[model samples]
Target: MDVTPVMSSASTPATGTTGSLAAMAQQAWGALSYAARTVGVPAGVRGLAVEVAYTAVHLSVYPWGLLDEALRPGGVHAHHRTDSLPPYERSRLVSDLDGSSTPVLLVHGIVDNRSIFHYLARTLRRRGHGTVQAVNYSPLTAFTGDIRTAARDLGDHVERLCAVSGVDRVHIVGHSLGGLISRYYVQRLGGDARVDTLVTLGTPHRGSAIAHLLPPTLVPRQLQPGSDLLRELEEPAPDCRTRFLAVWSRMDQLIIPQRNARLEHPDLDVENVRLEHVGHMAMTIDPEVVHLVACRLGRTRSPRDRIAPVAAAG
Candidate 1:
């Protein structure tokens, strides 16, 4: 009976097993914490928090101004709340030009109406960048219809704006998908003849990975990396006369790997402006962005000035 020392395998832990289990437990806790901080919170609750913060700031800083802007006739709210207005009326609202001046067309991103340009338009107007207008297109249309169709529509608006403003060329500013539409019009649709300078904010020129997160609809598909539409857009535009200024933020939540917002065409005149800690939506409201846009609009520089493409600024 030599049963002196019998050690069970289950009783003795293997070498590094304790460390591995501890590491796994730590990883699990970290994942749980991250989920709690992000997806665990109700979307409505987050929205409400943002609204509450905005309301508080509005009331505390400029209560009367906010009320007037909201309630007054032909005010921000009245003008932006154009859902009931006819298509012609909306277009007219955008194309209203008082005198002969360099027209600035504002194009908003996907799923957004022209109302998003309210603050930016006002800022441009105040900065004396006369005749600022915004164009609205359907997000569903972008999904169902080809992007070229949207470009054609934008071209039509540009032509109308130029005709009304008595200007042969207009400066275009677009955000997100609007920027893509503008570029298509300028490069592929021979819109460079009509557009002098093209400014884009938070645009995805190289396509965006975030598009994959969206439904596999037409627009999203077109916006994904290496899409046919994007490939066509990336083609050389040697004769394009438009000067491009691409403005992007480092912390843009929508444009995945934010550098996608930059324009990298070799044959075209493209400049990149980097913004710090600015969100995609805030790009339209930020004073610095407004000032940059105003300065670019204020002066009429020759296209040759942009011959050295790929200029960068902070």
Candidate 2:
């Protein structure tokens, strides 16, 4: 399949900042009050039930934390002990290259494991960007802690993989909460040194409506709006060495108010692109998202090359 990498226009107009704080605060308060009022009344019982059921099935079948010590492109589900899949080794773009192909690290969001990017990994590998790695985490833990720990683990995994592959640094692509984690790694944990590029798909950088809707006890208070993590991302930081591409979907059902899905930063190099049809989950499976990732991986063959999703249609 032919792939043309999509690049947002260079003219990245500054997103409006007027009343953003008040609006966000209002949303946060409303969500908090709603959760408070409906503490045990089953706030969105259907969504909660579906979320619980999906996780139960995944944990029962694919528990990987017990056996796997490393993360790879097509590694077994972190929840279930299984074999790690090799890096995507058949990129149409890098098939002819020697031993310097750039690696891509894939991470999933809350309540999810590495399987989220299975389709994307397979497609990118077929296109010749075979050095893909996926990170898995336990969903029951606090989301903030999970992101911090995952980044540290992922950095180590990248270093070890690079030693074996002879590639210095790799690209990072995160979905939903994963994206926020990647940002934390870069902003606070100094992950920019190890990553060449960062691509975030449907990440709720500013916080989410669903999080707001969840009862306070079920959701960690630290991850809520105005939390320490979001505060860090809000502050201006030096331009990271890693190029960033943020892909968002207008139809996101989980990220309430959808617009909060995109991160607005003043001192950063980024491309904010919006995809209309895909929802939060569809980002991992959609072909358009796959193609975009392939193009990024192909162009970023070496650490020197820097470059950087979608709706839910399953």
Candidate 3:
């Protein structure tokens, strides 16, 4: 049996490993024209040129996120409450434990650490999400570990966050491969019990053709189209209660067709939103993405029957 990604025609460049990215940039420049106009940025080649520069900037940020983050101390745990407070003050404390105070967990993609959310976390806090934080799975897992094992570890992290935050549920924003690990936890490992909303940015929900270019290592093999792991995720998920918001970008060269980022399952409650001119790594810091994520977490907007292009205010 032939086992490879559906888009096997996506060939690597003769120059070397990175030459493929340069080729994708050229394609992105052509495809990004209309999207650039929508965001009032320079069109076509110029738009993707900026994205290339941002990719370099994101590389500088990778070092800062090398270590796991410490849990911020702000959860309204029961031990912290007291009876000596005024009635009005006590009521406020009670409200803090309600759904309004649900925690937000940020998960980074393969080969990355919690530092990917440096800007996104700060932006969420600035937008009034008090408990926004990130959990860094081991970077080695991207190449050497089973995704199922990683999901189990993530579930453990979620439980710890719940214990400290005094809330039963949380909202998650997973970038790229991080999104896959999180979904495996949610759908296959019964994580819907804890996660209320899962937002995946640049996640290849249907598998990415780019994985075919790499050697068939354990984890990368699973990321290829029609891999066993992807097949397992495609299985029926009838009772999943957690909501999903999948964000895909037109200028994301890493995901190959880019539409691979869209999540389309028959039984899951999902909303897919598309954006133009944003690169795979740029999803976290893009002003529009930050604004949309804030609105979703803050409950500023209701679910829509149709997916629409949203532009953030300046």
Each candidate structure's TM-score, on Cα atoms with residue i matched to residue i, is 0.67, 0.66, 0.74
**lDDT (10s digit) by residue, model 2, range 203-222:** 88777756765546433543
List model 1 lDDT by residue over 1-114, tens digit each: 764334546544554588789899998897566445443456434533543554354335443433443455332222333355556434534553321156788887887656
Which regions of candidate 3 are displaced past 4 Å?
1-41, 67-100, 300-314
Question: How accurate locally, in lDDT, is each candidate?
Answer: 0.73, 0.65, 0.77
List residue ranges in candidate 1 displaced over 4 A. 1-100, 302-314
Question: Candidate 2, which segments miss by more than 4 Å at Cα?
Answer: 1-100, 143-146, 215-219, 301-314
Between prediction 2 and prediction 3, which has the larger TM-score?
A: 3
Checking candidate 3 for backbone clashes, the offending pairs are: 109-178
Q: Give each model's clash number.
A: 0, 23, 1
Which whole-number lDDT from 0 to 100 does residue 95 have in model 2?
Answer: 51
Q: How large is the C-alpha RMSD of every model relative to the true structure?
A: 12.1, 15.2, 9.9
